[model samples]
Target chain A: MLTAILSGDTPRSRILTVLLLAVLVCLAAAPFLFPGVRALETAATICIFIVLVASYDLLLGYTGIVSFAHTMFFGLGAYGVALASTHLGRSWGALLVGTASGAVAAAVLALLIGLFSLRVRAIFFAMITLAVASAVAVLVSQLFEITGGEDGLTYQIPRALTPAFRFGELFGVNLNGRIINYYLVFAASLVLFLLLLRIVNSPFGRVLQAIRENDFRAEAIGYRVVWYRTAATCLSAAVAALAGSLYAIWLRYVGPDTTLSFEIMLDILLMVVIGGMGTMYGAVLGAVIFVLAQNYLQSLMGVAAGAAEGLPVLPLLLDPNRWLMWLGILFILSVYFFPTGIVGRLRSGR
Target chain B: MSPGGANSPRPRPQGGVRLAARPDAGAAGHDPPTEAALTTTLLATDGLTVRFGGHVAVDAVTCAFRAGELTAIVGPNGAGKTTYFNLISGQIAASAGRVSLMGEDITRLSVAERCRRGLGRAFQLTNLFPDLTVLENVRLVIQARERKGFGLLSTAASHSGITTAAEAVLDRVRLADRAGSKVSELSHGNQRKLEVAMLIALDPRVYMFDEPTAGMSVDEAPVVLDLIAELKHDSDRTILLVEHKMDVIRTLADRIIVLHNGALAADGPPAEVMASDVVQEAYMGKALEDV
Candidate 1:
């Protein structure tokens, strides 16, 4: 399997195949090895994050078109699900409507922004995404009424097709409700990941890489350069929307601040970059690193919050604290030593 | 097999500049010029022209390229030889004039589309993707031909026939041993050879080779020249060569064109063009023997 995957096969295709197989094994062994149902549901949520980053990787890492507004699709997805469950609140139809709405909304946003900014190039593209995302955050926060402002909206976790599990009998562990959510997200993320892999291995995928390597040459070869870039952006936003919708459903809480924040965009971008751009596995690696760091920082901040007020070392992260500083340090180190990200360094060169 | 087959039309001089006036091989068409085979004009330009600010680089060139023959455009420095080639291949748009390939107007098409329609080009300045490996470079074009590109995220070069063709072309170019080497590692001569190998591996219906032998030792010229000659008679494609080497052209070009001051100064078989006064004046302001 290792030879089959890494032996000149496309980076993403092989990765997806390996990951899918692993996910299957993990799902099958979930009850036997793990004690809690909540953990399984949380794992599913993590898997969704993995797909979201992978899709973003295609645009940012592969094509080198970084848009900080990428997670806006996720927010769109969340809102779509929120409106559907509350007002449109149809049962079976919410899944399709939510996913499609999220994707379409994200794509529309990408298309509109891309029309103006795709012409800009380099750090300029990043600036546009940042500007747009920041603007969106402000609007969301200021709206107050429909978005519930800072209070956020609460709803029950959308029911999954799979039956909910009981941790009570197996290991005396209580999942509360995260187990079903875990499996639901895991299944969805795996399918999307595989589909992305297929697209990357096809003829269309090569153009993206070719564009990445040299856009001028690719254009000279008669490709519609801007159109392809826009298509990629649209696809990326759509996939991110899926994650956002799940965020709404999984947490049973929809908050404008969480969905529209620059901090969230920074986290997603950091995950992909620290994990590596252009390599599929980089997304998973990035998400893993990001989640772990968040958990660790939260704990560290908890300790410092109890200490001194003015000079708490963990500062914003620990005391009313700043997690951003530690995260920035992590990114700096990743850039310093593993400049190509984990997956990229291993994929290129003879 | 002389590449300019029996059907190639005796080129009709638009401005009455007879083939005999140009210096190098300016004699009349070897065998009364006949129409090139097939109804299709593989590459055609109608009054193609380019102007750079105040200076006119290429002026109103009207010509057509056909399959199964080797044609070269030759001239002295600053004569806009490469510029003319760029205008035809869509690297730069003609200030005025339409370029068409196989009956389709391609003046407005992007470079990649022209490539997809079987138009392949070799650059004068060594435009190989420097960071990619030798074999990987060839595989890129081959995979493009297979229509297996653009969609896949995989870095693997060959999953089928594309790999074999890439390897075979490398071997044909005698760079088979360097397949695993980075492009930067190859000797300059090998790099030039690799460029031709890259152009041919695509099996393009028309191969535009610009100065295939630019900076080679006298000895290295034959390897590339002979390769072009072989490619010419392959019966599968036509060849458009832009060369600076006279000996290489004298030995290989079926027909030669001289561009001087953005205009066609001569066009005829090699020996005839070599003996023309117009060609002489275009090059050094005197007949070939005086220089």
Candidate 2:
């Protein structure tokens, strides 16, 4: 509000301001430090993940509704765009239509899911979302007639910016030229991120948080609790769908595996939980950590596997995939060290 | 007994629970005293009834919450005090009668609809956004009010007007010092006060406060009561307070209404209502039994 913008240092806002600044600066510095544009691209992808985490925070953080099927919304956007553009013989116009349909699909799913679960307790809702996610994964995999099953779908997308990298001259673009996609995704993520930030700070956002903390009390004061939750879900779903669409565009491919994966759901849940539920910037923090860990773990696996095959000494090296053994350890540590996740850290003025 | 740290005060009065309304500095330029004063019928429930599956919680009770005055509904435990509040607030469906607000049929109105029509409420329980600052909670309601009045988003300068309005309400509630404090950080007493502040802060035409003083000490009780009186005496907004403390009711309310067994036991001036035979039997039996 006006007071928030005008006045200095209300406890939560102060923390938020600092965290936001740190996230932006770190992201800006990514390319310079990594010595390649690819590094910056990776950072942008992380920013997209932040969008996902932030949307989940709206549902899980502010509204206190943990949705296991939110990834389905994301996957819907990803695969929906692929099928629409490639099969329907379309272009950027199709991309626009695909985004709208993706959001609509998410809203419809939320409505049907919310109809039964909103009245039920929180844990029950979580269980139902989990059920939907699990079922959707199976359904997408079996529907070869529509989805092309495991083969997935990939189609060329027209890009005005592509020619800039076509010569492999500007910043030495090559087959590994994911840098442009990173910038594009980053720009989209930033726009959505800022909009979501305003929303959480808006009156509507406060009401959603109030509902999160306690619904019975909110209802007594004439807040239509159900409506607020449903609306929040819709907005959050649309954001997730956006991220999914961007993900497909970045990879230039989409498949049943992309839309149906529980891994994506777990990753999103982990991102928000690690970052902080109620805070928007926490999502960004969570995303950075998640993406970094994934890369680091994958690299470690590649090193260990390659080194194990031919090491000068101590040839007792194991496969890098063994790093999976440490994933549980890392998750436990993050949850333990930061009970409130990253949001709690920011709240403490970190 | 008050489950909260808000210790029981006056054994919970019987009948109507009224809350104070927001004060306007006469921006309307229409003098309430010179006018017919809204006919004291902002809300009316006709043969309104509610039943909880097997039991009739509120039975065929016809009552009206009027404009321009504070009317307190006080009753003992299980007297359908909350059931009645729920009926009016549209938290639950009315089994039978019609509820009309501002002469418009509002019986089937959703809670949000009632809010849109300048109706705000304070709960017997704290309904604050605990993580939000005291100022922010009021501001959200202000925004909610503005959205209802001016289609979601007005201009920036007009939005600043809402901030000013929120600031004034905080000052009125004596919570200006704690504007930056989260609801969770506030004491139990302050939370009760904040609940009272929120009820009046939105500048609603009608307010229903259920047991506004359930947790306050006798000293704190008077502060809330005086605020109620101040809000009602403004002559613009109407208030309905449910209180167990007769002293608060006697100090603040223009008229006192008593509900017993989900029916009107007494409705009149404080002294007259206090002397009713049914009210005496249902309410004062223990407090003044020996006398």
Candidate 3:
């Protein structure tokens, strides 16, 4: 199973495989072990973000393109599903419609950006995507009537996935809407993750890696660089949309802050870089580590803050109020030491 | 397996000043100068020109590469040999004039489009997918030939036909033993061989080799030159070799073209062009003996 997911037979790979399996088993059994809504919600968000970051890796790691517009697609998916559920109908059919519309819209947008902006050099292309993403985020916020302005939209999900539908008891635990929703998210995320694995292992995936390594050489060998880049962008955007739709459904809300924030984009970049660029396992590792830190770090900072105030001179060194500073310092240290990200360093066994 | 396989008409000299005259190689058991085969043009540039602001890089260079022959373009530094090759290969758009491949106009095609139409090019500088294995590099060339770039459902590793073909190409270049090694790990000469191997896998109709043996050590230069010679005879492909080594030119080139200050200085059979006074003054500097 380890060999199926990862390349090579090194000891590092074996260790990572075992670690990944442990994480998977733990996630699967989380609700039962913890038996609470908060734990279940945390586990579910981790799952959604796993899909999101993995899709982002398709561009950043595999295709060697740095796109800052990932969250735009994510927000598009959430908005699509949320709008469909409210206006069309709060049914499974509406969910399907929402997912399809969101993916298609994101694909078209990606294609257009790839066509027009990709002519620039790499760093410049990144700037163009950043500009376009920022502009769109503002557009989403300004459309107050339809997009609910800055507050965002809230709507019903399919009844089957809601608290109104109790699907009996399982293993002495009541299988209510909450438990069903968690399982649904878990199953969907797993399927998408595996599908992404299949894609990255295919010939098309090899071409993407080749492009990443040297697009000029790829073109010299007769591979149309633009078409391949555009295809990768579209595919990444489509998958991100799927993740966004799932997040909206899981939360029962879609807002500018929740769905389309630049902060979320920054978080994704940190996740991918911290996990490892190019390596699929890095996406998973990065998402799990970063999301967990995000959820608990503030509280940990609060505790440290109280303790630091009592200290003689350690107050400035580890300020409890500046969580971002601490995170940034850790990030710099990781980058300085690992250089290739945590997964890359671990796989290299250095 | 000469080019055209007894079907092509010989190339006719377009209206241009003849720099040197010499005996054609027809009497030496080569193909007789049927007006048809002698005039069969595989690639031709008509008044091709390029300029960077006010500095013209390639100035009105009109020449024809015959279907089965090897032509050497030689000149001193800053002579526009590489730029001319770039224009013909569509690396950069020509400022003016047209480039044609086998009678079809290709002046406006992109590099990849030109490649799809059987134009193979190797850069003066070694360019390769350095992160890919040597076999993987060749495999990508073959994969491009097979139009498998969009084969999302099929695994690139499991494609037996492509792998076998790629291995065969590696064997031809004698890099089969290092097939699994990364391109970056290979020596410079080996990288040159792998670049040639990639072009061979492309199976293009015309090959444009730009300074193929440029940076090789003395011991490795002859091996690459021999491989290139073998390629010319083995495939019967039209070859445009950009070389500065006069000995290499004398050994392999059927015809020689000398470029001076972005203009054609001399064009004819090797021995006759070697004897031209204009070539001596503009390119060879001291004399033919000094080089």
Candidate 4:
């Protein structure tokens, strides 16, 4: 059954399988297991980022396309939800309309970009995507009336999905709509992640990998390289948009800093590389490790700094404010040691 | 056997620039065969030309390949032999002309579209997916040929039919044992063998091999040649080979088309073309007495 769910693309290594299971279980029971408001927020962020990073993998790892417009798609979805919920009066139907429109808009934009730019060299494509993405970002910040500009939008979700509506207690934990919302994000993320797994293990996925390895040969082998690439771009954009919708729903707010920030884009890239490029399971590991480090690494650093107080330079270096530096060093070490990312290293049994 | 009759008009260089200024250059061995065989031309180029800046790499060189015959295209370095193959296979667009396959003009078609219309091309350089296993390299071609390349939900592993077909091709190429190994890890000879195996899996009506055995060991060369010979037995498949070795061509090609300075220097039976003075002078760079 597990094999069928994974599309028979097994994790390969025992350690990797265990790690994946642990991540799955932890995310599945994040509210009960972690049991803190901040912990739950971090868990939700990890879930959304997993979907985002995996969608990027579909482009970068599977199709060998480097796209910087992923966060733009993510922002589109958030804006879609924010606008619909505000104008149409915070209903499930409004959320549905927003999510659908966001995904469709993202797909259309991706198609246009792909048709215009995919025929060029890889570096040119990358540059075009970067240019398009930054333009979209500037447009969002300039459009104050509709997109809420830099301030962004704060809107209400359905009453059943908020913390105010309490049902009962279960296993000494409060049974409120907040936990229900967490499960909603978790369920959607799991389904989307599994669908992505199915995609990568399908014949279409194999063709994408073939293109990644050698686009010229893929073209000669009777596969329309441009067509396949465009299709992948559209699909990846739609999925990223969907992840954005879930993120908006979970946070009950949407903003440029939260969704459209270039920092988040770089974070997604780091997660994908840290996890592994081609392996779908890498997204899970990459998002979990990166998010945990982003959220808790500072506290961990503070604890280390306190312990190393007597040491001369060690405490200053281990200071919580230097967490970004520590993160950079971790990234370098991971790249230097694992090379293929954590999942790749584990699967190779090295 | 040569298909067209002596009365059939020959291909003339379109532009004013005469590449090989011999009057009898394109008119070799136009004798009508005694027995009229109803041969269908599978692939044909009409005034196919490509120019780089001012230099015409492939001059207005027109040629037709019919079913069941293996035609070897031989030329010296930079004779536009591979460039012609590229033009026909849709790798390089022609500066002026049309390419037709099975009676349909495919000049404007993309490489994949041409391949879908029964045009298969194997490169001189090994072009297998380096990251994928040997079986996977062949399997992708089979998947693309079977039109399952776009299947999203159906797992590739669920299709036992594709796996079986891919394994069969690998078995034919004698790389079945190395199927589990990555293409990058394979020996150079095995990589070449896998290239042929992928073409076989494609199973196009027209097979274009650009130096199929250019860098193979002696023992490895025979396997690919024998495979090509087997493919030639199929009367519906037309084979075009670009080779430099004289011995390989002598043993395999039914007809030889010699290209010099990107023009048709000689086109006829291998024996006739090999013995021609033009071929002797231009290709060999020496007279019969010089050797």
* Best-fitting candidate, scored by DockQ: 4
Q: Which runs of model 1 end up more than 4 angstroms from their true locations? A: A1-45, A108-153, A159-168, A301-323, A344-350, B1-40, B150-159, B180-188, B216-222, B284-291
Candidate 1 residue-wise lDDT, B1-291, digit = tens = 111124422233433234422112333422222465436457766666788886778766656666676777876677788898788777887888888887688888767778888788888988776655788778777876776655444544436577788899998888899998988888899899888888887788888889988887778777778888888777667788888666667777777776665655566666677666556544524334532
Which candidate, 1 or 2, would have the higher TM-score against the true structure? 2
CA RMSD, predictions in order = 7.0, 8.1, 6.4, 4.9
Candidate 1: C-alpha lDDT: 0.70
Q: How good is the docking of model 2, by CAPRI class? A: incorrect
Candidate 1 lDDT tens digits, A34-89: 55545454455557778888888888776778788876777888877776666655
In order, what lDDT does every prediction score? 0.70, 0.71, 0.82, 0.88
Candidate 1 chain A, poorest ten consecutive residues by summed lDDT:
A3-12
True contacts kept of each: 0.45, 0.21, 0.70, 0.95
Candidate 2 Cα errors over 4 Å, as ranges: A1-41, A88-97, A107-121, A159-165, A168-177, A220-222, A301-319, B1-39, B148-158, B234-237, B288-291
**Better candidate number, 2 or 3, judged by DockQ:** 3
Give per-residue lDDT, candidate 4, residue A205. 97
Interface RMSD of 1: 3.7
Candidate 2: tens digits of C-alpha lDDT, residues A1-350 = 63434222233657666766777777755544464655765776788788888888889888888788888888888877777778665477777777778878887888888876787888898899899888887777788878777778877665633324443433433432355556677788888877776666656776787688768656545577887888888888888888888887777788866655888788888888888778776788788888887767767666666766766643333456556666666778989988888668657755
Tens digit per residue, CA lDDT, model 3, B52-103 = 8878778777777887789999877788999999999888899988999887
Candidate with top TM-score is: 4
Clashing pairs in 4: none
Top lDDT: which candidate number? 4
Question: How high is each candidate's TM-score?
Answer: 0.81, 0.82, 0.90, 0.94
Cα displacement (angstroms), candidate 3, residue A287, comes to 0.3
